[model samples]
Target chain A: MATAPQLPTTRPLWARSPFYFNSTAHLLRIGRGKANNLQELLEALRLCPDSSIFRHTFQTLEEHHFIKEGFSNDFSHWAFAACNEVELAERLAIIDVREFTSIATLRDRLVLIIEEYLQKNPRAATRTAMEPFYLMDSDLVVVPTPYVARNLEEFADGLHKISIHSIYYHFIDARLRLKLNNNDFSIWLEKELDLAQAADRINRIDIYTSTLEGVRQNILKIIEIELATPDSAGPD
Target chain B: MKDKNPDRKTAVEEKNAEKNSKARDPKQQQEPATPAGQAAPQELAVPAAPSGTRERRFRQTDLPARVIERRKHPRISMEQPLPPAPPCLDDYVSIIGQPELDEIRFLARRLRGKTVKMVNSTAVGGGVAEILNRLIPLMNELEVPTRWDVITGGNDFYEVTKGFHNALHGGEYNLTQQIKDIFMSYSEQTRQRMEFTEDLFIIHDPQPVGLVHSKSQERGKWIWRCHMDLSNAHQGVWDFLKPMIEQYDAAVFSAPAFACQLPIPQYLFYPSIDPLSEKNRELPEEYINKVCDDFGIDRSRPVITQISRFDRLKDPVGVIEAYKLVKKYVDCQLVLAGGGATDDPEGAVVLQEVIEAAGDDPDVIILNLPPWSALEINALQRASTVIVQKSLKEGFGLTVTEGLWKEKPVVAGAVGGIPMQIIHKLTGVLVHSVEGCAYQIRYLLTHPEFATQLGKNGKEHAKENFLITVNLKRWLVLFQILLGMAKPNATI
Candidate 1:
């Protein structure tokens, strides 16, 4: 596995709702604590005097193994809803059943697909099963699932680039469906920005993306740069 | 987009202002349209009187003739204190188990020194307040410093917030600048007057959402706990409130789909009921009998009860309509009992509409009890053969949980948090409309064996999911994750 350089200063993915996870990370960093395992994380949180429902709910999930615990005892970097098939199925059943239809369907398909694929090519099926869902766009190819961030810095830098790719794909899809030319980008972009000024429109987009990803990319016209590609194979 | 329709906007604004004034001033109000869609008796426009006055008026209007006569005859003084409630700890422990006890200890160990404060709009009538009344004491017993606070405002604030609530539910209600100004002024006043020293600040619902803006010098984790279902929120309202919501340290929603693409990590917590509370606790047979007699409910006829605030969304009239439909085959009485929260100004009108819809039908009883009438609620639920929650839109019907906990099979709206409890053919039945609700109600009444099984299954499910003991453990784990104490080997 290759790791990126340092954590980026800004992340577009994070800016969407930076407070929850960002504050949790910041709080973990504050107490001079290194929590790798579920137990250790519980130990650190137990130190906090306030009985916040958020912390309590997480602890319950860990105890029940609804989420998968990390390999390291220091749980600074953790995954969201980390779990296995049985528990995942239980969680899935409880979900609102409205959103994530594709993901839900894919999960259902995976069981059958893996079985069939294995019958055809056992070696490849086994290898693919071991590998996670690495993000694959239409043009640019990334090795890791989503974007691989060696550290937080790269994670932040690639946030907007990745998002811009998604945005452009959506824009182009709508444009093609409506039989509109690519020239409609400026009008749509202005409407999206909801601003009077055109000069700093991309900057405003970067801010919007930052809220989603927790940090922003360094490149300002990263949307234009990423828009060179036609489409993406996976969700943003 | 709004700038394009200024004239239309003003017209709607004028209509709302007229409605609001009529709601506030009894003199300007007329009787609500009856069940047949005709004008009915003119109800006095009371300035949304407090619980005491409202209770007196309700007793005068709705209480059984015998009960009223008895009251006048002075058999027992209204001031006579009721007997002390029975010891509930043993029973609570027997059902919910010892983990609750251990979790409380651990919670005390963690939060003993810190203060946890809860802020909401209403203190006496709403579900949040009801839960807090029991929960705060339990927290204190466990040695965690806990306090509950009620945000104060006049009618204008509540009326504006009610509009915001409807808007959040995708209702096409546009609020004016004047209403916005009133809301801001109240928020500002509350921010100045409120003492914000707690380690954890929990603000519930849209009424106090702006309180996060008040956080100046003291910076702690501010959680905006939304109790409503936001899946279909009106775009205009969501767009307006999203920025304010973003300011919170974290956002907590009742269901997963209720969560949006906020940068904050959203936690899904199903609201729960305390089995130990007066409203939820089991009542004696005599008390149940007395309540049944007082409410003019026939003990022989299979009784169906839906206890909820008389809001349009609860569909009280729709509930009666369902009961009437069901009554065509089997003889069953319906009890629609609940009081309005202080914040919902439209409750009285809705209640009146329900009363008129019920008509002179002796079997259909509409009881708008006071907020503190816990024993009455318990009696009603106990006396009920079937419980129905016919809500058009619901966040979580705590009444359903309460009814299920009391071992009554329920037919509820398949919306919001209700589905989180009623598991179709398993625990209880979930219905979408009046016809569906009536079908389920009829099914339960016809099949006594199946109804009993459903009631038993519902109680078991309630024990597993909607109990406060389970809620306490969930909170414990969420805290552990925040403190970075989750097991490294554990997977979610």
Candidate 2:
């Protein structure tokens, strides 16, 4: 009779609210800060608004998503394309945006990279760019789409159908907006569904290697895999 | 349908009734019909009210009512019976896909009940009018009430505005006090005549930039939409116009490089083309062959074409030079075809120069097609082996967009907004000189597969970026931001 103790039953953790999908539209505007040379660029990097930094980094991915091979951020592209600073461009491009959650930290990293490069090569600071870097930012309007996902199955379907802009809003843009080190999908997957492994797989998606559409496909694949497991389902 | 201007309709109806009554009665017929405060029709001694005086009086008293009439029913601007229904939001789903259309609908849904009015210089000739012709209907279809009005001006006013247009495109022009006065006088007249009652007013280009002076008295947000390149604008012209531009709540440019430093925010909006329109719609092969035969274009030989106005800024002469260079290596025929606009007084002069540069080459065909020959132009573009847009200065190089949308390999100048459309061998080729353009043309001719790939890529780029749906979405987003229904989260 005392051979086995009663074991607790495994239960699911469900979210209080469904995840409402949202798409973002941008109203791009010229920012006050601009730069003609590496010195001015560094100064602008320090003084430009946080939104400008976000635009040059995160929004750039969406803007130039069609291009297969290029720098992922505007600063690197400008450094290489405008200033012909190959080493500097490489360094700037290597500063992954996903490594930081906030724009302030991103700005610090950008400033630090440029400052270090300038300290070593003093003449590079005065090197003039072919075209000036115009700091630009956008007014982000998040619109709620009709797509809503209450569980993993619905999320998989939503991923298959949502616009690329919605994917961008949730995956890359939410990190800065929500001050999370991970994307919206991963956070929701972990916090609501208690699916940490699937969430970690989604977070590991390489943004630089893929387009927004590519990212959507990868996310869909991960979600589909999770949905295939018997334990993926929650209580009816 | 409800009558938009009931008062004017009533007046017209009363005048008609009085005339009918006079015709019915012998005594009344004997008495000359007279306006309420004017002399009778039989009073020849009054010298006919000094030519336009009576008409001017009628206009001044009832101008606002007429404007309201035009705004409520856009068909009044044309004075024609209502035509067939225009392509709605669903019509665009075929071109831009369902998701894109859904996004536009979502944004437009948030902008419901917001009224928009677009003011420009012309209603017949240029790209702005053509856009509004299609855009207004689509916006109304989305439940966003939109109207378009063309500001009227005399030849003197138009001449000054043309000069300003050139200057803003980086050409030299003297901005004298007389010119400024002329522009302001016409602007003031237009402001008085038109009623600005919409929730958002988009005043396009510098001709109506002065209309923003009425913004303080009006109850709406004003936007100055500059469709020209202002990167190297003449300082004096920009100085004269800057104050008025600053009065707007925002400014929109066709490209980012065209924006200038200003206190108000500036937006980047690429001018778009309707894919389902006559100029861009797909055609039958037999019809294309007939169009080519009508234009004396040989279908057997390779045809390289450039479709744009014969303006010096478009560099039609440079295009001919490039064609000549390419002709040395590749035995291809070159077609330079375009139409003139009412606003461009210099078109004839440039067309003459282009003809001279062509120098009686039988292979070089220059057709001065009328503006209504959109289908012919479309046929010519579709029949082309390669498309070239060699402009020294361009606004947005929409011709390049058109060619790319037609899925023809394009070689465009690396100036203004051309670079935005042609991504240097990715979407299409970008060249800086006549020699470079010629070299690319020759290269594309030799490597047919590469050219085909470029065309495919170019079409996809145009589809993704420069469609009318994209333009509609941007506009709705801007309206939402202006109405304070959506906050622009600029800062983290």
Candidate 3:
């Protein structure tokens, strides 16, 4: 292989780095302690001895190899969500959809990981958060497929050829639901900075990209910038 | 710009005698027609009241008693010290996290002696004033010398600016050349009298947006902080204000989406609450009980509360409608808590409508609180079973953040920054209509476990996201970036 495989490694800068959280679950990890209740959390905050406070969020996406029932066998994907289509999630413990909808919930589930799960599926990694977790490799990987192409143009062309393949539609609904849930922060972005206009764009925008995947990628990229955008210094 | 001498104070008092005579003349005042098209209120001929009098709490500022009094005996421009810096932000480690602490430290070190001045119209009312009260102190404590100054204007000036405020918030307001002339004249007056030279001068909202024209007459890097939602700004008004806004070095907005077609680098700035402030602080049982008794609220009952200024935009009437729907399905009390801002003329009118909407419903408790009632505000939030912020349009709903801080599950309108706080079914619920609000409230009250979890999650979210420490970090990063000490694309 010309490129090394993308694997999960701890984020290097996270260490000796100030703690940042994506959600409330990360807030509970101060003093290497978890808040048992809201009162306890408030008390801890009031007494929190650290002089500097900052917010930073971390996510780890790892590739996993799983076999299909027939035809094309092995495939790899990077997900914070549990996989079920290829029975990979079933191979591990089943994730109740109700319980694992948020970043906080996923962090909690990762905390209670069984030793067997890590051993059997070394690639079945959960994103570690808040506390000083090890730095992980972020190099992205693509799993080998029988439909692999020769180049970027060839790969895009090959994907178009398989546009109607069942593989693409199998988990489309569930993936779309998760994206809708987690990717809607554009609406709440504050300041006299209102997203009313951007929201209008979301509704009115026509697909100008070459493919649905291309449009999804563009949307995701914009979301990354919007999410990374800092809060306004303007009035509430 | 004002130079004070003890001897000049005596002369200034003499000038007041002359000015006071003119202040009493109705012909001397220029009354701008109300933008909402209501009949102009009569200007009171009485001498403006003493600064701290009980009557100072009156609603309209068309001719602020204080402003009239000040014009009568115009004193040297005095630089008032803001509230002392609250406890060091470093003390908030477990809450704000460490990343914020490091950034503040870095920015403070970079801009050690630089002075930043903030100017706004009203000093007491509105979100801009409320946020500055807390933010100035925090910024000062972080070792950034910051000052907050209010622009001096009269009935004609503030009324005109109020029209601008309404127009920016999407109301159909037309700025006649007469109003534009008054705005520029007053802004020029403020520009001449006040010191506009600082490392950074933040002109807030529309009231002070005209102050940028003063930049030509002064020396300072100016950033206009617009806190109103202008997504639906009336184009006529926007066109009139665009050139004036373009005079600033940069513009800051509360949300990225509110960024218009401005030709300046715009930074997103979110407002935050001081965790240690009276409004968000943990209250003793004694204080909570006393407040509950005072308000006739039974803490044991399911209390659904909304704390916001009694503005039409806050939709207090809509809240009443939602409360009535919830009351039909389940037994619960709705507490509509808020007060009038000194600068807003429309509060009293909207408040009357809210009262009329409430009628004789004993279950609906409307406590119209006054300014400086932070403890009572805190107690009401603590006593609440669920907090609601159902705004029709919001810049960023601070009340919702406050509710979430108190560990109360909030049901807020799915508008503006409410979605940032509620996160729909995760921290709290976001609703679009009265029925939806009622449905969510009923769902929460009937399901205590779900509500409790939501509240817990909300408190954690507020702790991480909406606290002042997080805001300070972002602000410091802004300072560093502007000063060329940090990456322009820095994520604080």
Candidate 4:
């Protein structure tokens, strides 16, 4: 139910947006709490000229905890952000551990992770990390309306529940669970792809995985085209 | 007819004889197990008199050993008359034109005196029932003696079949061993009751697929007409049905994409919409306006609508989310109107979620019509600026065809037979996500000329590809092939 922030029309004072990645304790020094995107969060903490507005907006998680001070600005290195952002990916990876790595390495890693995290909950491994952007028109900071210092505990529980039970999320989970419980995912993938040797090359599945193994090459083509464009540019 | 298969003859004869000797008396001829068989019987053999206070319906009578399977199940042994369509096949001339009518009549010449029968689960309420209501009658008019038979099962049997339906369309299901027994045993009983075959016994979908087990008694051909997406059927269920499906002389799927690996020759045919049906016939503009007024839908604003039975797979909630997105941009009113089918029990639950999602949004209207509201359905389609069929998975969306027949632009899911109908931007738009649905609806509303042109193209496409006349032609050719009058590899 977490909504992405819709930017105001005119240049505003304080711009606050929710950070969407599952943040662990090691990466606590990331967001002031609320942030638009990772780049904005990193900019607010240690990289920006003014960091006070971010500190004020990204307030206590419930009572004590504030947004992480600063550690690694490297988390927003475009790739993960371009996909499900940080918090969302961490939350998702908590269920399907294959998500933690890059797409290129998913096939090899997915089977191993499914074996390890089948019914286990490494909950603390995916602690809450939000990076919201604050709206500031130079002098006065503008507060976004739906801004309540969201409970970190509640958010974490929501992510956990979503990963487990939400229809779209549970689909892959159910498939993965079948794999872990003596069901050969590779053999299933073989019939799914109508492949003779797909079971040999890949024993795991990506979320975008199709019955057609040949289509994986097509995704690479998209990545190539996507990389050619400038950061700000989007698909036409 | 023997390929030196005499070694198997003794075994086949024994099985056939065993089936021929059933527990029923001659007057109680068992009905063929239709997928959409009628639920309410005209006169049932109720208890002679009430003896004592009943705690519940069950534990009241001498309950069967499989009490849940037999008693708790939905009513199975009922019969409904074929809905009235064209009394004479000749009436289609003005609609389909003379050459097409003549063409169908010419094609029907070889099918005379040959028998064809349809086996489905229900005799009322779903698309299969609706189509056979008209198609069977029309075939009879063409001098082919075609019959429609429905199978009976209690409520438990339907619940299991509904699960299989969802699972075949890529939805998850928890099909326990008990439900599997319920499915197989009931199918066995129905098969025993209606084991007789004609020149062609066309079994529709998985409900009566077990009837193929009676192929030993087959004096002629049997065709398995699957009306759902089997591309992602649950592996276990598929494994169970695959052998039975393979035994058929041939199989028919609604789209080429639904085809799966099998040694038997498989044919693809789209489910057709009847042009003269109450739901598809062109309506007067004023009547359309009255439905809008009755539903409290605003005629002034751009109207976006989706009319589907309230089933989870139909993705009514997803449609609501898409409307919310479109509502952010366009000043429009969204209407989601649908009813229930006897086969599906999840309709009420899904309807509640749809209502909750639309939640106090005055612009969003939800209407739950009865199963017989064909005219109201017609009016809604006519009144709509755009019609959306945002299903997560579909078999062949005849509702999509119905909307197209009315020359209304449709936004539908790219799944199932929808892609065969909507050629992306050509006939209509096919959406993969809720956002895509909203974006397409917004685009069409903004660009009326393009939407109108798409609708025109959609109408022409449905006429050529998805009408009963075209379907009739195909069935005739298949009949010819079965009768050895046409080449096995022949195409219409």
Model number with the top lDDT = 2
* Index of the highest-TM-score prediction: 2
lDDT of 3 by residue, A39-155 (tens): 232233333322111111111000000111111101111111212223442322233222333434433443333233445555433433111111111111111123333222232
By lDDT rank, best first, the candidates go: 2, 4, 3, 1
| Candidate 3: tens digits of C-alpha lDDT, residues B121-199 | 7665456766776677667776788877777788998788778778877888867999989988988887887776678
Alpha-carbon lDDT of model 2: 0.77
> Each candidate's root-mean-square deviation in Å?
24.0, 13.5, 22.0, 26.2
Q: Write the per-residue lDDT of candidate 2 for residues B138-204, one digit (tens) a residue.
A: 8888899887777878899889988998898788998889999999999999889888788999988
Residue-pair clashes per candidate: 85, 0, 35, 51
Positional deviation of residue B371's Cα in model 2 after best superposition, in angstroms: 1.9
Docking class for candidate 2: acceptable
Positional deviation of residue A105's Cα in model 2 after best superposition, in angstroms: 2.5
TM-score of each: 0.55, 0.80, 0.55, 0.54
On DockQ, the candidate that comes out on top is 2
1 versus 2: better lDDT goes to: 2
Residue-wise C-alpha lDDT for candidate 2, range A1-236, written one tens digit per residue: 56787654332535656788888888677777779999999998888888889888988777666555554788997788678888999999888788888888899999999999999999989888766888888778787788988888778878887888888889988888777778889988888788888899999998887868888888888877876666776445
Give the poorly placed runs of model 1, Cα more than 4 Å off. A1-236, B1-91, B149-163, B172-197, B213-219, B234-237, B339-361, B487-489
lDDT of 4 by residue, B169-267 (tens): 778777678987998899899987874657888999999998887775538788998887777888878887888898998787776567677777566
Kindly list the interface RMSD, in angstroms, of each predicted candidate in the order they appear.
19.2, 2.2, 19.2, 32.3
